[model samples]
Target: MKLGEPTLDQLHIFIAVAEHGSFGGAAKAMGRAVSAVSYGIAQLEAQLALSLFDREGSRRPVLTPEGEGLLAEARAVVDGVDALLAKARSLHAGQEPSLTLVIDVMVPGEVAARVLGNFRRMFPTCALTLRIEGLGAVAACLIEGGADLAIGGPVIGDHPALERQAVGELDLVPVAAPSHPLARPDVAPGESRRHLQLVLTDRSPLTEGREFSVLSPLTWRLGDLGAKHSLLKEGLGWGNMPLGMVAGDLASGALVELDLPEKPGAHYGLSALWRRDTRLGPAASWLVDAFRDGLGD
Candidate 1:
């Protein structure tokens, strides 16, 4: 006789019986009759040509070695089917099946975490891919069709192919480690040009040959914001950082805020950006509002 493939329902029953430990328990959990549950398991075992449960001596049915071996695979099949059904439901409701979000590294981690936590609860079926980028890279991702949505800073301002909405602002303050020369009160604003500035380099060509708030010609261009932060803490260079990111360091004297003659700091405007021709999906729409509300507070 040829072997048969296990139906989804049979796999579910197999898992349910294994979890509840007996046919009666499985029946109560599944809202099926005990005899039906028993027959379903028997049918599954016969289809697979394996004895799933040993029902001989003990009052309760225990999983045979074969049953134990196949339990994980059965659960995986059931999970995959459930996910497929969920994706179908989301599609029917006009939700995006998946979204790719690129964010500027300047966005505070805590704020991102809170917004994403809410997103997970609101759209459990929508798969999310997250990328953290700096400068023009955020806008580049959206323009290149690599990202569905993005939260970016002023560098994205010149992109005409993208639509944007102001979400919030970040205060970029020049800071240096306490041990650095720039941290001294006597250091004049003009003297800042003598020291190396740890500037964030744009990975994309969108902002080539352009500078934003660059105070020093002597500079160390870093692609990663975290690396700049670490280098600043090590007294390797003086550079601007989001006030929210360096508040504790400023307070603890690990880093000192620079009193630059140019100005104390500038507010970097953050905007939610997406392709001009693409309509915002439900999850993406909700995310823009969430970022606005979360950052406003």
Candidate 2:
């Protein structure tokens, strides 16, 4: 607050220098020219008609009495601005910082890597965290204030709090190594279905209480996609795998697609659940779009 004029930018710079104790440090942190930072601080002090800092350069800038009051206010203002910018940048760059997105069990590490890699590339300064867990875990995170966004399986998610979106459809088709006996054309698809199979999800296809329950049999039960893919590649067993997860192995002839009599599948589902009563934070809104764009392909 000032008699002549006031600027949010000037106050921001002043607070940065005051907190950092150096004009150069503030400039470096804010990605602004050193001279510009110093000038902005000078303008801020002039408008307030008070010497905010005792900048005699003895050691560090000591705050004067009037500056102390302003410092408290400035901190709150700057923190608000930071949150605002994080939201704005998420919208602009199509990525969010400090986001908690729910991930499905079948969502491979590779897919997460690609999306988060692109996000970090676009917003280097952002703080992005990834939580990898089951679909139930994902839904719990979204509903209980643990995470801002989530990618949960429809099978595990039944919460009335969520607003789900159909980003893209994925097939959990069975795959095996090229050299596996059933992979040969002479072997019938029905015969292949009986061979040893690798199960990925913790819960079987029957857990959803679907009308149908005749799923193909797999001998080995594994948790992660990487392990399942590895087992499949080794000709240990056929696995109903995420198409995206086995892309590399398929292309490289390390794994061959198995023809299943009945295609046992799961829909690539995403449920964005927030407290409907509470307004969606700017960060949350931006994150929803970012994930949609990434997975919508």
Output the number of the lDDT-best candidate.
1
Q: List candidate 1 segments past 4 Å from native.
A: 117-124
lDDT of 1 by residue, 122-187 (tens): 998999999999999999999899999999998757678999899999898999999998877766
Model 1: lDDT equals: 0.92
Model 2, position 74: C-alpha lDDT score? 82
Clashes of 1: 0
Cα deviation of 64, candidate 2, in Å: 27
TM-score versus the correct structure, for each prediction: 0.91, 0.58
Q: What does candidate 2 score on TM?
A: 0.58
The superposed Cα distance between candidate 1 and the true structure at residue 69, in angstroms, equals 1.6
lDDT of 2: 0.68
